[model samples]
Target: MFTFEIFREEVITCYKEKKQQHKLYSQLENPSPGNLRNLCLIIFSNGLSKEDTQTFNEFFNPLNQSNELETSINRFDLDKLRPLRNFILGKAKNPKDEVVKLLAILVDFQPRPYENWKKSNSTTVIENDNVESGEKDSSEIEAEIPVNTEQAITALNDANSLKSNSKSKYLVVTLGLVLLLGVFLFIKYGTLQKQCMYWNNDRYIAVDCKEKIPGSEVIALDEHKLNNFRRITRPDTLSNKDVSRVWYSKVNNSVEFFTEPGHHPLYDKPLKAVTAYILNQHALEIKN
Candidate 1:
């Protein structure tokens, strides 16, 4: 019995078969540029039902006047592109489907598929200058339509803001790392290079010198190699006798050496005088 349910089922089966064929077409190994046109022709001739063929003809009749089929395909409305895109997606998702065999024949044909259109509920409203028998002007209709964009606009703004903040953080981190690296290199290499010095004995040494007054203890000629002192006069050049005791006089600002006070007239005067030290070692010894 030819019931309404059976008729509806047959229509559904026809659509399913069309989808399967489209999937095969997408997976073709190599197809000529005219493969889609030829396939459409074949569908018109044999694949489609009489009603479907009639609908297809009505849709494409105006495009027949144009020589460029690609241009006509580009002008396809969302209603027409949705089914084709879904078919291609179905093929991509299922590699082992029997319908994938058609890809071998349609491989050479390249078609640009519609992207992100599946999620949109946007409608294309036609605007005609001439009003139909009872229809109002498209301008008035368009004015009455409300556009919903809050969610999309907010999502887009948030994404852009996040990207900008990420870039700023990356730049700051890179600069900070570079600055730290420079400081580390300076501390390790620059300070060592500056510390190097040549001693009076023609030997290299790292002298730990500091700023001080010339007459202070820190500036004295000493045995330590790291000291900043330099020997100006030798001990032997100052006196011929053995002078064990050395005193520095503030009035003369010179080193005065004292030998045993013998019965010499020069005992009141210094036996040896040098241009460098100033110290009262006798008081320190008595105190100790």
Candidate 2:
């Protein structure tokens, strides 16, 4: 966890100091831990645009909006982020605006247990280091368990469990919690492929979901089809493929795709027809 309160303060300080917007941008261009990059982008996208909104719009396109959304949600208080939220909301005249999805994902985020531990122990040496020397720091090993992997695995597989082990009395509850949380989050959110849907021209279309926002709509594609799309487009290994963007409308309570490229013929229709087409075509892939 970052010193979110301090970061919020710094952001406010920068704005209040009347630093040139580009100067602020330059300073924020290289923030520590990388997660702060999104906050900076949001600030620039919202604040700096006042001078030349059209140019700003032209320079920072929809694809960049999705890229900012891909960044991880950090531990900032909703109260502190209110200014940014309000700024974004005020600009997003359309409820289906792509920025709305960015805000939604940030608000809906749930930090993991391991993330909590890391934040809590950020300054501690044990938390930052690996047990490479086959030795566990007493502070890190809070529970009386075999610290070695071989011993731990044997203890876990044994019918009697660690009870039969003369070396330790109990399992590492903290370790178990970390592993469980890691696995759960991985299964729940990590396996999603590089697929996303975007709203465009009164309808939706399939696109590269850089942000990988969950529950976004997508054109039904076979594993084979996706591989082919990836091969043909060959998105920058660093970035997502340049494709149309998507949004989630809180009003409609459904994923909205941009009807830009008409990635699928059925997605190019007007609202009603597009909705019906998606319901009919991607029915199997649609989430309940």
Candidate 3:
């Protein structure tokens, strides 16, 4: 597995080190699926140096084309990445360490079964050639020297026992590590979920629930409100007529309207533009 969460953490750490404002920062802060895809595109499109760009283009031909780059980034195409990894390893200096890390993850996502197969095939071929040339096989030589069949059987059984024990130990260790990782992730996610903000004067700002302010009202964190923070993107098709003075929550059986553009404040949903249909259908309700 690529371990996207680890990769994301690395990217954020690197971004913090740079301490510069960029599209990558925004994507990191709110890593929705679309934002993550855009983050990859932004890194490739703008983050690479001149030499790195040339090298990338050389390995992934015609990646200068927007569509080609988009497809490669979207898929994390390993077929196109393995060569790039080899090239980077052979390079004298690699300025883009993040890109190198990404390539490493993508290229090493799966074990190369073919390498093992090739080694096995070569050994078999060499053994066949020796037999054809009338060379005594190791088995044949050992057969003449083996005087104690019982001892040989006992040794073979012991070897198999050791191998079985080793496999059992490995499996146990692997399962233990997986369980630890799961517990860590669960704790981390729970902490993030608990991180909520209270609506201050005009805008919401995160604060310690334990601290008390003298004059101003100090409200506790509301997970629902924090989770519902909306990032509205205006559609290109939207017109003046479709736009309204107030925002509207998404229609269910009944439409609820808001005075401003944000979340529903109570529901786990975002507020969107009040369409003409909502205006007409809820006209009687709005007057009251």
**In every candidate, how many clashes are there?**
8, 10, 0
For model 3, residues 1-288, the per-residue Cα lDDT tens digits are 234444434433454443342212333344344444444454463356454444345434444555464455556544444333333334323334345444432222222222333465577788768645533333344354445888777656655665566568679989999999999998756555434355443345666665555554445554323433332332332333333544667646766554344465445476665767666666433444
Candidate 2 colliding pairs: 1-119, 198-245, 198-246, 198-257, 198-258, 199-257, 199-258, 200-258, 200-259, 204-257
Candidate 2 differs from the real structure by a C-alpha RMSD in angstroms, to one decimal, of 19.0
TM-score of each: 0.21, 0.21, 0.26
RMSD of each: 42.6, 19.0, 18.4
Model 3 segments beyond 4 Å from truth?
Answer: 1-196, 200-207, 212-224, 231-273, 277-288
lDDT per residue (tens digit) for residues 192-281 in model 1: 533433333321245344533233223222222233223323334333121222222222444333221111111234333222322223
**Which of the predicted structures, 2 or 3, would earn the higher TM-score when compared with the native?**
3
Worst 10 residues of 2 by lDDT: 230-239
